[model samples]
Target chain A: MQLEVKPKGHTVFVYIKGEIDLQETERLRQEVDRYIDHHGMDHLVFDLTQVNFIDSSGVGGIIGRYRKMKDIGGKMSIVGAKPTVEKVLIFSGIQKIIPLYQTEKDRIKAEK
Target chain B: MNVNEKDFRVKNQIRLTIQSRAENVAFVRACTAAFASQMDYTLEEIDEIRLAVSEAVSNSIIHGYKNDPYSQVELYITLWENGGIEIVVEDHGCGIADLKQAMEPTFSTEPGRMGLGFAFMQSFMDQVEVKSRVGQGTTVILKRKVRQPVESKN
Candidate 1:
């Protein structure tokens, strides 16, 4: 998996490409957390458009990041989840805690 | 227990044994998804199968083997003639003492781990049965029926 971060004002958009599974979740978690901490971003937008598959481990990793961000009074949202990836998120009930948007522009607009 | 028993008739069966390493989890998922593809399952169904298989194999590696790379986790896939697929992931590592508590959602024994493995398996497959003994091992069996695409009614 590849993680790229784009800073737009106080919100940072993280573009994750490839499958998020047990093999790659830890690296993803570390990279996202490190980027967020270094940039001192107050909000996060996880772009999952290119992610084709996600398992429970991926869900756990996302939730972990959510908690980390929440503890610091920050916000996080997920955008561009494919149907298959969306099913996993919805099934795991992560969508209830974190808002899911169809596109990054929608998520950014909603946050505004 | 006769060799000619009807229950022994499996149209196609494949068994794979791999080390309990994190890298092997993806291999297991890919192999199971490929096997399920033989039934001509839709992409959505195949993704679900892959997710379920990854969860089970991850549990075997993380919880069962405790990240012990030398341990082995076995995966078995069977395709029945009746358009049904069965997958079994087994490990001879540490077994769960309380099966009920283990199956509960969000019940992870370790930090940074979500206890939704069994939940995903149960949600994705038509049937999920887990059998484990404290000292023996754990075996998770998942079954799903594939529907063949119908011809257009032109």
Candidate 2:
């Protein structure tokens, strides 16, 4: 999987491309944490439209990141998860804590 | 696990032995999906099998092998003529002592893990049978039935 970070105002958007399964979740957590630490960016958006698949390990990675985000007194949101991927996320019960949006625009709209 | 005589009639079968590494999880997922696709299963069913297969392989790598990367995970897949499938993922590593607690949702021996592996296997598939011997290994058997293909949702 490939991970890229974009900073817009106070929020950081993470564009993930590829499958987020057991093999790649550790790298995901480490890289995203690095971005958050190095830039000190708070509000985070995970752009998952390009993610092909995700399993429990990926869910755990997201939940682990949420805990870090909470500890830092910040917010995190998920954007553009396909139907299958969305179902896995829901089954893991992470959607109850992290708001999921169809797009970054939708998240911005929800904020207002 | 109840024995069904019909389930013994395997239309197709496959066996694989992979290294106990994280990367092999995706390999197992892809292989299972490809093998199951030969039948009349839908795309969603294929994805479900893929997810369940991934979870089982991940558990072996993380909990069973303890991330040793040198161990082995064997997979036995049987496709029934009636559009049903049985997948067995096995690992010879540290085993679970408390099977009941291990299957509980949100219960994990390792921290930072969701502990939803068994749950996902049980949820996505029709049946999930777990057999483990502490200090010997663990085996996960997943079965699903997709006899009739529904209207394609394209």
Candidate 3:
């Protein structure tokens, strides 16, 4: 998996590509956590457009990050989830907790 | 009494064994997804199968083998003549003590785990049956029927 981080004002946009499964969840968790800790961003946005596959472990990693942000009075949102990835998120009930947006522009606009 | 073996036909079958490791999880999924592609499954179906297979293999690597690199995980895929697929993921590691409790959602023995592996398998596939014996091994069987393309009217 590849992760790209871009800081836009108070939010950190994390663009993830490739498959997110048990193999990549630990690295993803560590990277996101480290970035959040260092940047002190108030909002975390995940761009999953390029992500093709995700399993329960991947969902767990996302939930863990969401919890981490929430504990710090911050928010996290997910955008551009493929249909297959969206189904797993919905089935795992992550969609209800984290807002799902179609694009980064929509996510930023919603937060405004 | 002799049974006619010719009466039963096997369409396609494959067996794979890999060391119990996190990296091999994706490999298992990719192999199964590629095999299922021959059935003309939609992208959605393929994703579901991949997810289910990943969960099963992850369970073996994490819970079953407990990160033991020496242990091996076996995967079997069989395509039936009726356009159905059967997948079996087996591991000769620590098995579940209570199958009932293990199948329940949100019942994880490890921290930071959702314990939804079986749930995803059940939700995605038509049938999911688990057989295990503590100190022996565990085998997860998943079956799904491929949707036939709609016939066009001439």
Candidate 4:
């Protein structure tokens, strides 16, 4: 998976591409953690618009990160997950905890 | 959890063997996705097959083999003339002690896991069957029936 991190307004937006599975979760976790730590961001945003596939491992990784953000009094949000990836995330029951936005503007509106 | 062979007829088949490794998960996903594309499946249907296969293979590598590179994982895919498909992912690793509990959504024996492998398989596919012997190995069978003349939800 490819990730590009953009730090904006106390939030680190992670744009991920390709697939998120067992092989990519570890690296994604490490990299996102690094960006969160280095940028000292107070919020995390995941841009899954380009991500096509994810499995349980990816869900686990996302939850782990969510916990990390919660521990630090920070927040995380996700935007633009396609129907397929959204199915797995919703089936895992993560939407109950983290906020999911179908578009970038939708998240902005909700946060506002 | 027996997949009665009498339920469907096979028109095409493919079998693959790969060492248990994290990277092979994508390889297996791509191969199965490509194979499913041979049928007149919708993009969403094709994506479901990809996700289910990914979850099964990931379980084999992560849970069964425990990331052991020396172990091998086997996959058997059969295509039905009606655009239906069945896949069996088998692994020779530590097997689950309780199949029912393992299939439970969000129940994971592994630390820091959501344990949604079987959940995803069961949710996206028409049928999911698992057979495992503790300390022996595990096999995951996934099947999806084609919805003929079904158009995309566009």
For each candidate in turn, the interface RMSD (Å) is 0.9, 0.5, 0.7, 0.8
Candidate 2, A1-112: lDDT as tens digits: 9999899999889899999998899999999899878888679889999998999999999989888889899999999999999999999888899999988789889976
Candidate 4 A-chain TM-score:
0.97
Point to the candidate with the largest lDDT. Answer: 2
Q: Find the candidate with the highest TM-score and give its number.
A: 2
List where candidate 2 sits over 4 angstroms from the true fold.
B1-8, B149-154
lDDT string for model 2 (B47-149, tens) is 9999999999999999999999999999999987656889999999999999999999999989999999999999999999999999999999999987573
Q: List DockQ, one per candidate, in order.
A: 0.88, 0.93, 0.86, 0.90
* Tens-place lDDT digits, model 1, residues A1-112: 8889899888888899998988889898888889877877788888999999899999999999999899889989999999889989998999889999999789868877
Comparing 1 with 2 on TM-score, the higher-scoring candidate is 2
> Interface RMSD value for candidate 4, one decimal?
0.8
Indicate the worst ten consecutive residues by lDDT in candidate 4 chain B: B145-154
Task: Please report, as a residue range, the 10-residue window in candidate 4 chain A with the lowest summed lDDT.
Answer: A32-41
Q: What's the ranking of the predictions by DockQ, best on top?
A: 2, 4, 1, 3
> Candidate 3, residue A19: CA error in Å?
0.4
- Which regions of candidate 3 deviate over 4 angstroms? B1-8, B149-154
DockQ of 4: 0.90
Strongest candidate by DockQ: 2
